[model samples]
Target: MMDSPDSLVYLDGVSKLYATPQGLLPAVRQVTLDVRAGEFYSLLGSSGSGKTTTLRLIGGFEIPDSGRVMLGGEDVTQLPPHRRNLHTVFQNYALFPHLNVAQNIAYPLKIAQLPSAEIKLRVEAALEMFRITGLGERRPAQLSGGQQQRVALARALIGRPKVLLLDEPLSALDAKIREEVRQELRELQRQTNLTFIYVTHDQEEALALSDRVAVMQQGRVEQVGSPREIYDCPASLFVAQFIGKANFLTGRVLQTDPLTVMVQNLPIRASAMGYQPQLDETVTLMIRPEQLQIAESQPDAAPTAVQAATQAAAQLSVNQLSGRVIGDTYVGQLLQVQIETALGRLTATVLGKASLSSEVNLTWLVSACTVIPPALATMPSP
Candidate 1:
């Protein structure tokens, strides 16, 4: 992957393993990743998904059992952490309690044997960069969680490394402060134009802050794409379910067209997304919850009005289905409605408040449905 022109960091078929009482375990499978210069990329996954281990390998804190780690087209797999040109901001902040904020930020510069004047100048600039100039003389105990986080960031950026590794740095902060800090970190990355490699399991944070996201599961990358692509056109059933809430419909393809598939004897249409299914193929169609619209089903309404309205919806490529409301849940800004239909139990996310009614119509765009392999769709949970 490093053969590319502007790629800054590349992991070529990297893998790491550990021996425990249970036996040998693979922490990171044969994974290959390429991060471009000045791009915000995130490794998003749950616990034990090998994200933290992968970051450590790039920083030279952990060596890969096989394959190479390259930086700026040069091999650095065997180099020590100190020999690498990158800095890490850990989740715990790892600040020193004995030293003041200024001293903590200036420690790296002092160790490099720079002149005192240059060290002082860089420390002052870093303090100002993080908006903590007034807290320079304060100790870690005297600062709030947000303030201490800024100090850690200033220390990491003071040396101006080529790459910055963030290992769930905002996980320690509260929700309100975490959002504030997330915005600050994004703005900081933009101003410096530094290549940031962030690791987190929070989908919202990853989607909001990253230019691209790499979703990992069981030590391997499930998918890598922009937020929209990952959410809309997932490569596999696992990916579609992982990125967000999706309703899966299992069916067999009776016929195929350039832009549509006949699933379970029903012709379903989709926008031009390059989808081509073979005849008699069993596939699972995925539709996101937010894409569905729910309206009260009127049995006594005139068929003419319903037909006209249905035709308009179909012109926009919307698919219609009749279902009975099984349950309704209030979740903040949206109401989660579960319905029982011929396709099975489906969940729809309706905006604002919705009346808990018995009969309803579910409307979704055909372009929103993604088809995946049938075996994976029906795979039993482990």
Candidate 2:
């Protein structure tokens, strides 16, 4: 396949395996990716999902068993790390404890055998750019985690590499500090306009920091898209469940036109944007917790009236389900409520709290639900 002209890094059918005692273990399987220049692209997955291995392959730390790695449209599969125009900021920060901040930032320039005056000038600029000008003499052990992170970033960027690779760089900081550093990292990327390939297992971190995210599972890439696209229109059930909290309903297809499914004898309208379910085919519907709206049920309303209202709403491509609130939990700004219906226990997130054992009505738009055909329920390993 031809690499995109804008792609700074391209992986063509890359695969890697490790020789384990159990036998050969596949770490990455025929993964093809195109990372455009000057974009924050993330490799997101849980542990053992090949995200780190893929990063290493691109960084020349690990060579693929098959396929090629392209950097700036040049094949660099067998090149060493220093030969490539890229820098990696690891999880541990990997700062030289013996050296101070300025010395650490100037190490790369010194290695290139640049003039001493130029090295000092660049080191000063890096310290000022990372807001650590006053801490130039502070060692890594004396600095806070966030400060050390910034120093490492300053060092990596001081070399002016074409791309920067980050491996869970904020995993060591506290929640508040991590959030602060994450924003700084994103802003830094934008200011420098350098391409970034970040690897992280945190879903929220990946979503908040990346321009595009590649969701990986069991050594393969399942889906790749913008944060909103990955969340709203997942390619597989794994992607949906991994990205955020999802409520699922199993039902059989009742109609193809505008796609309607029957759950517990109630017609539920769902979006068939990426899936096509045949007549009477068993399928699963996925709706995000935030997409569902809950309201108190009228005490004077009859069961027949509720049923009639549901049917009427279905005709307009809306889904209405009535149930008793079985669980309610206060989660800061949002209240999570679980409803026990005939179909199953469905969870929803609302702004206000609902009392347990109270009857309620749940409604969601047809576009809010994604239909997952059985074939896509579990993606097979490649």
Candidate 3:
């Protein structure tokens, strides 16, 4: 959260567990992460996935079972929430009931015992930062949800907290306002140089806002990578299924190479890996919904990329089933189509409705698929 270029916040082997009736329920199991200074990082997961717990741990509202929480490389695991110099903005914008916007923004400065003139200056500046200058006199009960969120943000920012903890602060607003505020938050983070630890279950929000994301599940990080890395090449089965629409075809490795793998007779392009597969190993082939395209039926021709794909053992092993469109849904700028092929039902996203007819032939380009070692499905999370 420090503005210094060399500073970072780290959670080394940080674990948070609860005493449940059955056993010690781990909410966050030995998470080790580094949030570089000035990065807009997100902790993305559903409820109980330990994202909020991570935020609370860094903010000092919750303690980890074991490990270190360091700020600017200084150990601060035992520090109280108030001593962490981080501010948290909740979904409901927990503003003081009796305080008006001006007082709410000024509250932190006042609590720090700054002079009245300085408090006024800070409050005005905070309001300006959020473009809510005229609403400073309005109490929380009198403002719209979006305005209330701004006030809460202003209150948190007035103290100039090193890190900003946003717990789905925009979730309560309408779609339009949510997008507006989302842009506002990102711009503010850019201008302020404050490290942000954002929590969210929404995939698009995470993809759009984060410099990097730590995708969580059942209290542990499954994959931590850039939006593109996580989406294009997921580390585990959980991550592939969690982040977006993915088609997985279970198969065994037929051949291996550093850049690609032949699985279940399908020539599957593998992710950028330091390790290659061994032949005959079990593996999962993953293709994103958008990655695949409906290839035009072709007569005999020389080997193209698709032809090379058609020749892969994986393609031969799996039954060839071109499908007809059973149904389709138009989602802004894209078409979500359901295809009933001989293999099974598969989903795809195309640019737009090519034809409204229920009969649409389907084939996928091999260039769009990749292989994930089947061992990952059962592998223990770190």
Best by lDDT: 2
lDDT for residue 163 in candidate 2, whole number 0-100: 95
For candidate 1, list the clashing residue pairs, or say none: none
Q: 173-272, model 2: which lDDT tens digit per residue? A: 9898898888999999999999999999999999999999999998899899999989988888889899999998888999999799998788899999
Q: Give the TM-score comparing model 1 with the true structure, all chains together.
A: 0.92
lDDT of 2 at 364: 93
> What TM-score fits each model?
0.92, 0.94, 0.86
Cα distance off (Å), candidate 2, residue 340:
0.6
What is the per-residue lDDT of model 1 for residues 1-382, given as tens digits with 9 covering 90 to 100? 3357788989988999978899989899888899999999999999999999999999999999998999988899999999889999988999999999999999888878899999999999888888898898999989998988999888888888999999999999999999989999999999999999999999889989999999988788778898888888877777777788999876666556534556555666544352466776766788889988888888897679888887886756778888988888999888999998877889999886556558888888877877764333343221
Tell me, by TM-score, which candidate is best: 2
Instruction: Please give the lDDT score for candidate 3.
Output: 0.78
Candidate 2 Cα misplacement greater than 4 A, ranges:
299-315, 373-382
Clashes of 2: 0
What does candidate 1 score in Cα RMSD to the true structure? 3.3
Clashes of 1: 0
